[model samples]
Target chain A: MEFINDLMQYEFLQKAFFTSIMVGIISGVIGSFIILRGMALMGDAISHAVLPGVAISFMLGINYFYGAVLMGVLAAVAIGVVTQHSRIKNDSSIGIVFTAFFALGIIFISKAQTATDLTQILFGNVLSVRTSDMWITLVIGGIVLLTVVLFYKELLVSSFDETMAQAYGLPTRAIHYLVMVLLTLVTVASLQTVGVVLVVAMLITPASTAYLLTNKLWIMILLSALIGAFSSVVGLYFSFVYNLSSGAVIVLVATFLFVLAFIFAPKQGVLWRSIRARKSKSAA
Target chain B: MTGTVSVKNLHVSYHGKEVVKNISFEFNSHKLIGIIGPNGAGKSTLMKAVLNLIPKDKGKISFAGDSVEQVRKNIAYVPQRSDIDWDFPITVIDTVLIGRYPKLGLFRRPKKSDKAFAYKCLKQVNMEEFADRQIAELSGGQQQRVFLARALAQEAEYFFLDEPFVGIDVASEKTIISILKKLRDSGKTVFVVHHDLTKVVSYFDELILINKQLIGAGPTQEVIKPEVMNKAYNIDFDLLNQMGVGV
Candidate 1:
């Protein structure tokens, strides 16, 4: 009770709460499409691939956010180009590009003139998110949400059934790139909270949990956003009371919810499925 | 129902080897056509090329004397059922509502009238009750019915279905055939990639028999002859005789 009252008193805690929730919502919304399209790993790749851009941007005395977003988008484009031009396939292409960019980021960090904190960039310090960073997250989150609303039908049709989208002349290639761009934006937005190593978790877990619970895309999306926001707010509370890493706490909370859904989701859950199976067998 | 599809020297190649080699045929609307062949005989390749879904190495495909791009809106394709992710989280109505996407263009949401039209299509296929159901939960035949409803909602003049009968219940098959027949009767063009030989005469008005190339194409009775069968499929002589193809 005291913790709840104190949470409102600390401005940093307030910033942490708002930023984490927004990140969760953005990631969870785009994450639904990411998981459904089987691009969860691609999301991971883009997140990791942005590291080099961040380091280079720091070296250039510019906002690392721009550099990180640019690199993320470039990595997406490069992955597409590699898969299209080579027989290595998509997963392999993602592996190659991300590792390469990540290595370059590490090297850039080591060679940088400034004292770069790898841990901070990798795991994020959500409690320390500046007001400017909060504004960045807010603007980007609003843009992503708006774009998703405007193209909800296209994304749903394209991600659910690419062949049908192509047949409908829906500009599926453009839709593919649009998804990549949205993913990049979400990753950039999430960098302050979950960082690169775990942003994919935020993008995948809540959406996947909702997926196990609902059949309708809109419901799934809504449920995912709710779960995301819930986890962030709760996780931030725990982080403050327990003095733990805020980013890790947020991701752990998302995963915790996923585990709950995996084991307890109605009709589709593992425990229910087994229980039903046992009942049918005994009756037989 | 208002155009013709003409393919001239259509060819599709992958990795420098031709999958569909030198195929040419033309057909007008208001007919039900079947493309049949043995596995790996480019039956899908040919159909996709006609719609320019696949890159054509050497060909000209035109619809109603215009390029395929200009008339693509009139053509709707129902891909093979197995090709889709059935586990996708979408209701049947929304699945059918995708048919309105082309008409809705890039930025618009599906209007309420679009939902009503989708509901009507679901009713046509006897799947309105399952409109809110997840596609994954439906049986194979029901899933096929949903795809058909989606195609129907497109309101296209020419419909191309890939293996619509594969893995479907008898009732659904009958419903699909009757729908195709009705569409044909109403002067729309319906092209189905089918494998069942016994019902060709009853199901399709014309046939495009292929084995990596165009072997024969004409009215079912004329195209299903033994000479064409020999070219299209290396089946037993007795089976050909049973099929009543004249040797």
Candidate 2:
């Protein structure tokens, strides 16, 4: 009750609340594509690779959004180039590039020693979210959602069968790079709420939970967004009431929902499968 | 809508090793053409290169008198069943509906007529009952039928299928072959990458024999001779005799 009362009274809390929910919703939306393409590790790599850009922006006295997106895209291209040109697989290339960027970021942060708590960039403090950050999140969220709605058919076909899409002259490579750019924008938008380290959790957990619950892509996306938003609300309340890290609490809530779905989803749940198996055995 | 696909000196390589070596063949429209080769032969590579799915080292693939780009929308391809992730979260109808994407282009959704056409394609394959079911719940034959239905839904002038008969049930193979024959009879060109030499005489009107090179390409009777089989397979020609391939 007090948390709700404080939310109504406080402006910063309102910004934080709204921003986190937007982050949650957008994360779920883009995460659906990421997981479906089997690019979960790419999400992780891009999120971590953004740290160097964040640090550079801080040192240069500019917003990290521009730097973060630039570095994320560059890292994605680098990973692609490496995997394509060599015998090394995609996961290895992602590991090499993201770690190099992350190490550079750590060195820059320690050397520059900015007045702001840089720790917040690593582990988010949603309570201190600015008005500008909130607006940026909302705008990015709108663009990401709108893009998905407009290109639903292309994304579905290209992701499902690359050769077929190519035969149809769909420019599958361009579609892949488009998704990569959207991922970069999403990662940048998520920084204020979940930060760099936990952003992938926000991205994948709700989507995975939704995956277990539904067999349709649109339904999974819808359920994922709802789960993500619900987690944000509950996570924010708990973090506000108790002096806890908002990012950590939000990730935990999303994970808990995944656990519930994993055990109880009607068609896919392990428990239900076991019961169905036993029934069939007895009947036989 | 009938057209010919002519390959002029087509050469494709992978990882600096040539998979298809200086091969060339012209496939006529209004016929069922089979690409026959050994296990490691470049039948699939040839199809992919012709479709521009993979990079060709050197080649000219022309549909009718136009380049591939000019006639891309009129071409439809179904890759091997093993190439797909069957567990992907998609309904049979939605999978079939993807065939309309080229016509719909960007920024446009499928209209009611498109859906009806997709359903008709599924009906042609006798898979209309499984329209709403998830793709993973299907048997191998049913899955092949679904893919064939998707290709049918494209309504293209040219169709390329990679091993559509491999690992499928007899009923599905019959259904798919009959559909292909019907399409061919309607003056649409159909190319299938087939491995079973036993069915070569019965399934295809024309055959392209290859083992990294074009051994022969003509009517089934002329191309499936003992000498051409020896050149492509390097196997005992007696096996062809035993299989009653009309060699």
Candidate 3:
């Protein structure tokens, strides 16, 4: 209860709270498409691949956002090129490219001797989010969220049916690259809240939970964002009261929601499926 | 431009292997045309190449005597049913509304008229009742009709479908063919990759027969000759030869 009230008393706590919520909203909204397109592994790949970008950015004393975004987009493009040019499938391409980038990141960090801690980069320090970081999250999150809004229809068709989108002269390839770019932006925003390793989970879990609840894409997106934000706020409280890692607790809360949806969602859940199965058995 | 499509000396290869080699045919007349071939005959590949969905190793596809680029807006292609992931969470209304996407212009959602038109297409395909349901929950035939509705919403002059009848219910097949016939009668050129030979004469006004290269193409009655049939199927058309027109 005291933790919940800390928002009114502590300005830093408020910054952490708002930053995590913004992170949740971005994750939920963009993650809907990621899960819908079966790009979970791709999300995982891009997040992991951003490490090298961060390391280089730290080494060069540049804003980490620029480097991470650059690296993430490059990694995505590399994955696309590899899959398209070779016999290697998408999953294998992602695995090969991301791991190499990640290895390079490790090497860069080891040699740089910079103050940028590897553990901090890998696992974020959400509790220490400054006012400036909060503003950065807001700007980045707003841009991506607005982009998603502007291109909702384009993204829908291209993601749902690329061939058909192409038939319409929709520039499917360009749209694909644009999606990768936005994903990179989203990943960079997430890096401060959930760190690199847990970023994909934040992106995928809430969307997946919403997917279990609804068949409509818009509804699923709405549900996902709401669930994501709720989890963030609740997780922030839990972290405050228990002195737990905010990022880890946030992810756990999101996963808990997913588990709840998986078991008990009315539209398509294990419980409902079993109930339907048993009803058929009784009828027979 | 009015509906007409021409494929000239088209060659498609994958991994250094020729899938479709030296195929050329001119299809006009704004009529329903069936592209029939045995499995692995590159029928699907031919459609994909013509639509520029797959890169053709060599050759040109023209529409209305122009390169495909100028007339691309007039064309709509529905790939095979198996090519899609049905489990994607999109409602039927939205799926059909995607047909309007090409016409929707930039940064525009489906407008009121688009919604009405999508609903109208659903009605035409007798799928209006299922518009709100998730597409994956529907049966195979219903799913095919939903795709057809989407294509119809495109309002294109040239329609290309890969196996519209494969693995679908008879009612859906009938509905789809009727819709195609209507489109043709309304002066839209329709091209389909078809497999069933027995119903060829009944379904299409023209037939494009192929193995890898073009075997014969023209009015269905004139092109289903025994030699052409033999060339396409690698079997003596003796059985079809006995039915009169094969010879």
Candidate 4:
């Protein structure tokens, strides 16, 4: 009891816990849309693409979040433009741009004299989150959540049928760009809590698991956010006790939830549907 | 119902090659017009040009004595089923709701009344039961019905359908034809880009035949004579007769 109380008293641990919860909520909400749009790999690509931006920002003594968000949005626009204007497939464009940027980031990091711990960028240490980063995460997450709710109907229409949305004069191009911007914001906000490597997992897994359980978009969003928050808290607790990386543990917990949802979700899940089909066939 | 569509000296190209030569036509409301042509004859291009879905090299199209942008609300278009991604994660209900988007305008949600109207349109097409089902799970025929239901929800005075009956079951084809006829009867102009010649005589009130240019157009029975069919299709009538599409 005294040890648990003592752990709670530490400022860094409390800051990390609060930051992880905020990151989880934000990633969960935005990630639901990302998963629905099948942009999971794109999210991963953006995370990697932001590394060069971060390295350059660090060298220039600038705020890394701004640099990350800027480059993330640029990467998204490049992918969108390349896929739409060129004959190349979208995944190929993503792979090309992300790998190239990531390679440049690695070069920049290796050449730097300061030699900041590379693991801090690759796999985040949640215990190191400063109060400023926590505040930034909360503010950005709040803005993203508000924007999503405000443009819910428009986003839903455009995501479901972009051509039809354009035919009806819905400004689908603007919506497409807006979605990319929002995705960049979510990716940057998640950097401190989950690191660049595992952030995409948080953005994709919870929503995908929720998708298997519900057909309603609103319900899916709510469920994803809840699942994400639950995973963050549990993962944080487990890591505190067992001395594991919190970000990786959180992602693993989310993945486990996804596996469970895949197997056991009522109507759309694999196991339940198979069993129901067998039972009906035998009855017939 | 009194609107007239006029296309003057329209020329269209795809990838720098002129596909639809100088063509002109005037169509009025309440008429069921069929655009017929052989494969690669630019019938679809002309229709798209009229809708402003494609850019014309040279032309002026006026709808109801106004430009397309000025009178956009009066037109509704149904694209070919193949043009859409069927794997899109949307329900039949949401698909029909998109038709109401143009009517709802910006920053406005589909209200209770709009949703009720959408349900009524679905019921008209006998697709009310599948409202919540994912569009990808539906068969080709059901998909066509859903698109038709969306058109019905649009409530436009002018409608365009591109090969709506392609790959659909006979019953679905009959249902679509009946619905289109009802639209015509109610004084809404409808243009159908159709391929089947056998049903042209009975299905359309008027026909416009095309082969890179306007061939002939008039009442179906008059426009479908051997000479006109040959000019539009670029095939001898005897050859079509041999293939069992009687002249």
User: What DockQ, on C-alphas, does every prediction get?
Assistant: 0.77, 0.84, 0.80, 0.35
**Model 1, runs deviating above 4 Å:** B236-239, B242-247
Cα lDDT of model 4 by residue, A175-265, tens digit? 8778888888887777776788998999999988888887777788889998888898778777777878888999999999999999999
Q: Is the docking of candidate 2 incorrect, acceptable, medium or high quality?
A: high
Give stretches of model 3 more than 4 Å off: B240-247
Candidate 4 C-alpha error for residue B87, in Å: 5.5
User: A-chain TM-score in candidate 2?
Assistant: 0.98
Worst 10 residues of 1 chain B by lDDT: B238-247
Q: Could you give the C-alpha RMSD of every candidate to the true structure, in order shown?
A: 1.8, 1.4, 1.8, 3.2
Give TM-scores for every candidate, taking all chains together and pairing residue i with residue i.
Answer: 0.97, 0.98, 0.97, 0.88
Ranking by DockQ: 2, 3, 1, 4
- lDDT digits (tens) for residues B81-196 of candidate 2: 99998867899999999998888889999999999999999999999999999999999999999999999889899999999998989999999999999999999999999999
Compute the interface RMSD for each candidate structure.
1.2, 0.9, 1.1, 2.5
- Name the best candidate (by lDDT): 2
Model 3 residue B113 distance off true place after TM-score fit, in angstroms: 1.4
> Worst lDDT window (10 residues) for model 3 chain B?
B238-247
For B126-198, candidate 1 gives per-residue lDDT tens digits of: 9999888888889999999999998899999889999999988999999999999999888888889998787
Model 4 whole-model lDDT (C-alpha atoms): 0.84
The local distance difference test score of model 3 is 0.88
Q: Report residue A212 deviation for candidate 1 (angstroms).
A: 0.6
